[model samples]
Each structure stands twice: as C-alpha cells, then as structure tokens.
Target: MPEKVKTDLGFADLQCRKSDVGRISRIAKAAYSFNRRFFGKEIKKPFHIIICYSRKEFDDIWGAETDAWLTGFATKTGTIVSFRDDLIRKYNPRKEATLAGTLRHEINHIFYFQIYGSYEPAWLLEGLTLQPPFEPFTLMENDKKRLKGPLPHLIYSTNGKTFFKQAPFLYSMAFLATRH
Candidate 1:
C-alpha cells in the first residue's frame, strides 16, 4: 500500500496508511467535535493528522526523544502523530481503555497549545487532556504503582520529551489530578 492516504476531515487534513483512513477519520472527527465544544473554540485553519502504521514508522517520524510507550502526541503547530488503534491494541494492552481517545488526547494538546500558547506547564497540558468529555479515563494496574512515588517527577516535567519519557507513570497521575 501507499505510505499514506490523504483525506480532508473538515477540521483536519489527514495522512495515514490506506487501511487507517476510515478508523482514523472517525476518531479525528470525534476529537474535533469534542475539542470544539470543550474548549469553546474551533480550529479555524485545517490542521494535519499523520497516522503511522507501525512503531518503526512512528519512531522515524518522532526521531529523537521518541518514547517507546506513547500511542499519540501533538505538535505545537497543530499536528497529531499516532499509530492506528489496532497497532496500539496489539502492543499496549495497558492503554486499551483509552485507545479510542488517543486522537482526542492529541487534539486536546493542540487545543491547549492554541489557547495557552507554548511554554505552558506540561502537567496542566497533560492533566487537562485526560479530563472528562473525551474518554471515560480508566487506570490499569501499572497506573496504580506510579501513584506511590514522589510526584515531582510527574509534576515538574515541562516538555513533551520529559513528560513522555515517563509517560507510563506520568499520564496516570496526570489523569488522576484532573479527574475532579
């Protein structure tokens, strides 16, 4: 198949493996609608969403600072980089409950960046992304263990590289902080 199939999803211009077009499109649409209503702002310009079919592809795009465990992430310029849900499901059962919200979480980061600008604290950015109206926010056993450690590592992270380097631990705490 072609490396990627391109399509316009109204709010986003997507590029993905031919097989991911349908599934990614659905998630992107839901993410767009959720962000629009939750943030009370619409992405006026069409942003980009790139879905990688495998870990090598994702790592190639991510390059330096690539975290082995991240399912998806957003850039400051309004882009979402991710694996399709099937790929995520096979490798990371821990993230299963939040699989459908991966795009939404990335979209949430985009909205957060758009509204707050860059340099906002990573905890706030991550915490808010895991907040309600997007996904049901479930925690697995691994998540529970992270809560036992000192939080400075999770709370002090100020960039994606640092936050995602410890994403497995940080994301769970981030969600817990925002669950109210």
Candidate 2:
C-alpha cells in the first residue's frame, strides 16, 4: 500500500498517494493557472481534493460503485479525483491532459456553485467546464446532435434512478442549449 501525502494550494488542498504527488501537483498547477487566466482569480473558497490510487479505494471513499468510468467529481465543498495505479503505469501520453481536464471541469463546478448559489442545468454546467470547442459558450457537433432529443425542462426533483439514467443525454442537450 502507498502512503498518503497532502499539499495545500491555499485555495485548494490535495490529498493523494505519495507515489502520485508529482502528477497531482502538476494537475493542480495547471488547473489553477487555467482558472486564474480565465476566471481572473483563484477559487473564492477553499476546497479539498481527494485522489484515490485504485478503483477499490475510490469506491470505498466515495461509496459509489462508479465502475472506474468516472475519473472524478465535484461538490459544493470540494472535488474527488481518481487514478488507478495500474492504469497509470501503462504508457499513455494523454493521461496528464485527461487529469488536468477533469480537475478543470470540477473546479468550474465549484466556482459556479458558489457564484450562482443554485445548480444550473447539467449541460450548462458541463459545457462551461469542458475544454475549448466544448467551452462554456461554444457548440460542437455532438451538442447539436443532442439538441434533437427530448430535453429536460427542470433540473431539480428528478429521482436518483431517473437522474442517473438520463444524465448523459440531458447534459448534452443542456450544453447545446447553453451554447445557443
């Protein structure tokens, strides 16, 4: 088992396995830089970043059987990022980019939650968070395709099962509408 290490970024704090310190730091730096450049400042409130080293660890901590498909998520208070050690050991040039992207996505959620004081549509939330081409106000081919489907009118009160079931399509549509 790997030992845990924690680093404070002032605006955010990171806790991850010792072996993953360098990668987590790089991701944090990139996320902070991106937020500063675009948002004009660091996040207004401090948040926690918990990084798990394996699927089991992530599930255990989050209490969700995310099945490794979810690399991370954010809440009003913080973000959770995961990197399966076995997966990282494999050669992949895009790994860092993916991690940084996830961090950026989560950070945007936290920022928006604080600023708006209420949750926005999933598409708007994710679109704003996703990287360029899918950035806040930009539309992509997928977003256009998603617009043709049934769209959710309200963002609240949907049951958990229904919300999870419709998440992918609904978020895509929301992103398209936001762009428009």
Candidate 3:
C-alpha cells in the first residue's frame, strides 16, 4: 500500500516498498515542479502516480507478460512508472535519472490529453508530449540501420496498434518538427 502526498497541482500518491520512499519522493517532487512550470495551473482533476519497485511487481499489477523495457505509461486517470530493481542493482547506474525522465514524459501525456482532449493528431499529440527536455533520441540510440530512411513516411504509416513499437523514432521526429 502507498500513502498520499499533498501537492498544489492535483492529487498525488506514492506506492513502493519502504526502502524506495525517499527516491520516489524526489522523483515525484520533480514531476510536480515540471507540471507547475509547464501547465501554469493545477490540473482539473487529481493525478495519481504509482512507482512499482520492480518489473515483476509492474507486470503483476498490469497483467503484462514481458519484462518491461518501456519503463512507464499514462492514461487519463494516472501514470505508472516502473524501475527494474534487479537491473538497477546489477547494470544501470542511471536508473533513477531514467525514472525521473519517464515520470515527466508520462505525466506530460496525461496533462496534454486533459487540456486538448484525446482527439488530437498522433504526431501533434506526441510532439507536444515530448516538449519537456528529455532524451527522446535514446530510444533509437543503438539502431543505426533503422535511422536511414525518410522519417515522416515511417511516422505517417504508424497507427495506434503499431505506435508503441515506433514511438521512440516517431516521437523524436515529431518533437523536432513541432518544436520549431
């Protein structure tokens, strides 16, 4: 179970094991700060946040079958951010930073949906969502072969079903295109 943390923007909650409270709190604070600066007002409804301590916990809660590589996602109601505790312990030193960025990114999705409604074009919606400073390029960082073509064509062909797989490339391209 998690405890409620009061914030000016909206309803905030944290769910993690006792060992993770401090780190998760810091991420939450940063996210709230970003929301305050970007949106300039409290969101019309409460925003709930859940920090899963491990990928297993995340999969169990969401009924997902795979080891989660995507990190986080958001819907109208809330955002779920996951940290791979085992991987963090053994491999990634920047896990917390990644967690913070993912939270910001996912929360932005919720914020944009609330303000614009869900009917916005995918390119515009994703571009606006990526407005916050984070490494959108990191998704395709290692895929040199995939980076060779006309990006817009690839982006235009993607639909909701394929969006998740193509999001990293599409999001970066959309962000670059829309930011100007």
Better of 2 and 3 by lDDT: 2
lDDT of 3 at 162: 77
Model 3 spans > 4 angstroms off: 1-10, 66-68, 84-97, 129-144, 154-160
Question: Residue pairs in steric clash, candidate 2?
Answer: 123-175
On TM-score, the candidate that comes out on top is 1
- Listed per candidate, the RMSD to the true structure in angstroms reads 2.6, 4.4, 4.4
Model 2 over residues 1-180: C-alpha lDDT tens digits? 878878887778889777777877887777767766766655577888887667777677666676334566676555655453345333222234356666776777777777776455555676566546323334446656666676556344334476667654555555545556
Error of 2 at 27 (Å): 1.6
TM-score of 1: 0.83
Candidate 3 residue-wise lDDT, 1-180, digit = tens: 454343332356666666676777777778767865787866666666766665676667666654334556675555555553454433342344366666676667777777777725666766665664643434345343445665444355444557667755676677666777
What's the ranking of the predictions by lDDT, best on top?
Answer: 1, 2, 3
Off by over 4 Å in 1: 93-99, 149-156
Higher-lDDT candidate among 1 and 2? 1
